[model samples]
Target: MKVLRRWTAALSALSLLVVALPASAAPATRWEPCPVAGSAERQECATLTVPLDHRDPHGRKIDLRISRIPAKGTSRGALVIIPGGPGNSGLNRPSTVNFPAEIRESFDLIGFDPRGVGQSSPVSCGMAAADARRLTPWPGPDGDISENIATAKRMSEACARNGGDVLRHISTRNEARDIDEIRKALGRSKISYWGLSYGTYVGATYATLFPQRTDRVVLDSSDDPDPRRVARGWLANYAVGFEDRFPDFARWAADPANPLRLADSPDAVRPLFLDLAAKLDRAPQDWPGAVPPKLNGNALRETLLRGLSTDAGFPLLARTMAAARDGSPAPVPVLPPDAVLQNISAVAAATICQDVTWPRDIDRIARDVQRNRARYPLTAGMPANAGICSSWPHQPAERPVEVTSHGPANVLLVQNRRDVATPLSGAWKLREAFGRRAVMVTVDAGGHGSYLATGNACGDTTVTKYLLGGARPAHDLHC
Candidate 1:
């Protein structure tokens, strides 16, 4: 899940499986050239219709946009590419992402826009642009959440008013079911998977629900798969994740050769950033072309959240911080189209909110925020603050899927030690949940995704070897 201002930031299960139709009764998928420009000639697009509610297999149906890049050599099977964000589109990944030649040649790479995303029957809350920016409940400069509570109520009401039945049915468990449908459509009983960020959870859920159907599974940058906490835990992790990842940026920002250097030493960097954020809270700088049109403390924090995801983004973040600290002309923040944001916000709200129940008591939530603010000043308690889910009109369609070590030992977990979004601590929880069923490779690196990212040769080699050949270290390995 990508960072959004305030609270909106961005699940799994199995029975269980949905009843399948006879092979002759199932619709035959016809693959045609993808409509996206610059898409590779090898890539083809198709649509698979899935039940809106898996329980009611014979009821209303929705289409999922899927893409595939056939193998270069004799294919072993399919490798499904799952994108992050309960909202991110995966249909173009088969063409956009550069996979190693060996892996691409060994299997047919597949991608899809999960239900309620992209061309897969998208949903919206009909929220005004301003309301969308208020998705996260960042407190006032004085640590007051009065406005945050009000914003939550408004956003919740808007979603209930505008989001249709599609929003109600959007969930992690359903997504796993959809993947199973894709497997059936492709005429494969078992498939390999490569999932990133939130996609890791989707992959885990698929593996748990259909353990027998998963061949080789790779979960990169995992989320804590605690069914009780669910998305709330992911949100709260930002407080610790930011602290863990900040030092890496601090080292880069304090380097003498860096043009955007903010301090003389790494130790001075944290104080500098905290002071700058406090100053922004008191007086926001005008930032044209950005959502809310101002560079406030939370806006700066959002920049940190995104920038810490990759080393390539460090300079952009440094530049933004330098501008804020010096009161220089604010860099114009590029934003996605309003329609895109609307769709993402709606899907994020629905999936996170309906995955599990949240505290409806404003006072209970307020206490949590206050405590979080005191302990972790960098995030300013936003991670602990309640969002639209607290006031969400609907309840979860089913219980959150508990991912246990009940499946095959085919799972491989790869992680960055200091990922800001999905931190190592949270990944550990997932690792423990998988138990002996999964082998973890923790890279001594920073940023979010790990495999082929962060340039850790050992981590990359371990994951590649696992995908190419079914080999994993006898125990959890640290690179």
Candidate 2:
């Protein structure tokens, strides 16, 4: 009687499985000839409709502008490229960014504008560039919080008034769901992801929730996947991150061979920078039409921060510094176009504000800023300072995804030794969460993203070997 009962149960499971399988999968994306100038490889563009709110799948929908460069031959699967910047779009990575063409040719290079970014249904907070510049995560030069607090509230209000319901739904979880929807739309069961900077957090969240759906995952220049930190932590780390990455710039600037040499020695570079900033703070350059309309000390500081993001930016910083010191007409500052800035700021603010609640208390923020200044003067207490999120109108729609090591063993983390934005320390925290599941390739280089830029040949080779040939180092390998 017992054997008969077990057989009946097993037969019932088989019957359910047979009935559950779909006769045919969802329709594949229709391919078209997309001729983009300056692109040597064949590329195509299309849109996939995803829910604005995943909770109501049948409700309103938004188009995700997805681009793909199909493989030259038989493909492994779709290699989705996730761009950095909570505001950055992946839509141009395959063709625009300097991703290795050899690896790109091995698989379908897929890029998409995450919900409110790029060619997708973009959202704007209607913020002027001037207003955006004033609202800093960093406090004022003297650690004054009055303006910072006001800006925070004003910025939050601007977002609340300008960014509507769609803003509330732009969390990492929703983005991950959208990714799965893209997978379904493309008729793929699994996908390989290559995420940079903030995209690392997004990719990690996707892996946490849909482990089985991930393949050949590469998190380059990772953020602290800490639920409490989220964007808050990334914002705060600018101070520390700049400190870590600036030294590399200093050494390069000190090199006499460089046309835009700053100082005689690496030691002189640091003090020269500090002195220049202080002098400028007292009296800004008379340049017009720049971000602040005058090249102030903070403007120089901000340029330094961006310059240190990668090794390629070293010259920009040195030349700018040289020109400023020489009292030459300041080079025209090139900020993103107005429309692009609006879209980016809206997405960045909404994502930060909606992901989790930042401290609303001004006193605590002020104190943190004070401490931050004393400890790290490069950013002058900005990282610890409050911004728009402090006074965000709505509550978080969902909890931050807790990244764990429970996912498939296909995760690979490639990091630079001294990245200012996503430092090695934070990457270690992410590595700890993933435990043995992720094998890290720490390159002995100083830049934000490791796979291609600023990374040594070994690091790029390792990542390419993994993405193309499905090979991962047996252990954490330092290149």
Q: What is the TM-score of each candidate against the true structure?
A: 0.93, 0.92
Off by over 4 Å in 2: 1-28, 134-136
Poorest lDDT segment (10 consecutive residues) of candidate 2: 1-10
Show pairs that collide, candidate 2. Answer: 138-382
Q: List, residue by residue over 178-291, the lDDT tens digit for candidate 2.
A: 888766655566789898888898899899999998988999998988898788888876776878887899889999898888899999998888778877878888877676
C-alpha lDDT of all candidate models, in order? 0.85, 0.79
Per-residue accuracy of model 1 over 363-472 as CA lDDT, tens digit each: 88888888999999989999999888888999998999999999789999999999999999999999999998999999999998999888899999999899999998
Best by TM-score: 1
Give candidate 2's error at residue 155 in angstroms: 2.0
